[model samples]
Target: MKATWNGVTLAESDDTVVVEGNHYFPESSLKREYVSFSNHRTSCAWKGQAHYYSLFVNGEMNPDAVWYYPEPSEAAAQIKGRVAFWKGVKVEE
Candidate 1:
């Protein structure tokens, strides 16, 4: 899968974990140069707390557009070390 936003590729990986219709790409697949820190956070009963990373690409900012569970619950362990995109970011094959 490839995650793109603002005409830039945020991440791309053939190996992905799908949960709740979102494709979680490997952390290593992310293009760190386009990533920025974000204090935003959210929780999922089964996935634990999710941390966020905003994207800065093509002179545009997409806040909290990427999220990942730093320490996911046992049931969601498969997603550990992975990140997923949303907030208008497109994930496609």
Candidate 2:
């Protein structure tokens, strides 16, 4: 699977976890250079706190486009350290 935006392939990985229709790509798939740490956060009782990564490609920024559970709840342990996307970023199988 690949996560793309603004003509850039931000991340790609064959090993992914699908939870609630969202594809959580392995951390290795991410392009660290294009990702900037963001202050945004969200919560899910089962998943714990979600840390965000803003996508900055060619000077265009997409805040909170990527998120992950660094420390997941027991119910969501399978997706820990994996990243997922939203807010218009394309996730292609």
Candidate 3:
């Protein structure tokens, strides 16, 4: 699978895990230079707190477009450290 925004592929990997209809891509798939920490955060009953990331591509910024569970709830612990993107970002197989 791949994560793309503004025609830039920020992450790509064959080892993505799908949980609750979201594709949790591995951190290794991401292009580190294009992603930065975001102030945004949200909680899911099963997943726990999700940290966000803003994606920068060729000077364009997409805030809170990527999110992950730094420390997941026991129910979602398998996806800990994995990332998922949304808010106009595309994740495709």
Number of clashing pairs per prediction, in order: 0, 0, 0
Off by over 4 Å in 1: none
Evaluate residue 24 in candidate 1 and report its C-alpha lDDT on the 0 to 100 scale: 96
User: Top model by lDDT, which number?
Assistant: 1
Clashing pairs in 2: none
In candidate 1, what are the lDDT values of residues 24-88, reduced to their tens digit? 99999999999999999999988999999999998889999999999999999999999999999
TM-score for each candidate, following the candidate numbering: 0.98, 0.96, 0.95
Q: Pick the candidate with the highest TM-score.
A: 1
Cα-based RMSD of the predictions, in order? Answer: 0.5, 0.8, 0.9
Give the backbone clash total of model 1: 0
* Candidate 3 regions with alpha-carbon error over 4 angstroms: none
- Name the Cα RMSD for model 1: 0.5
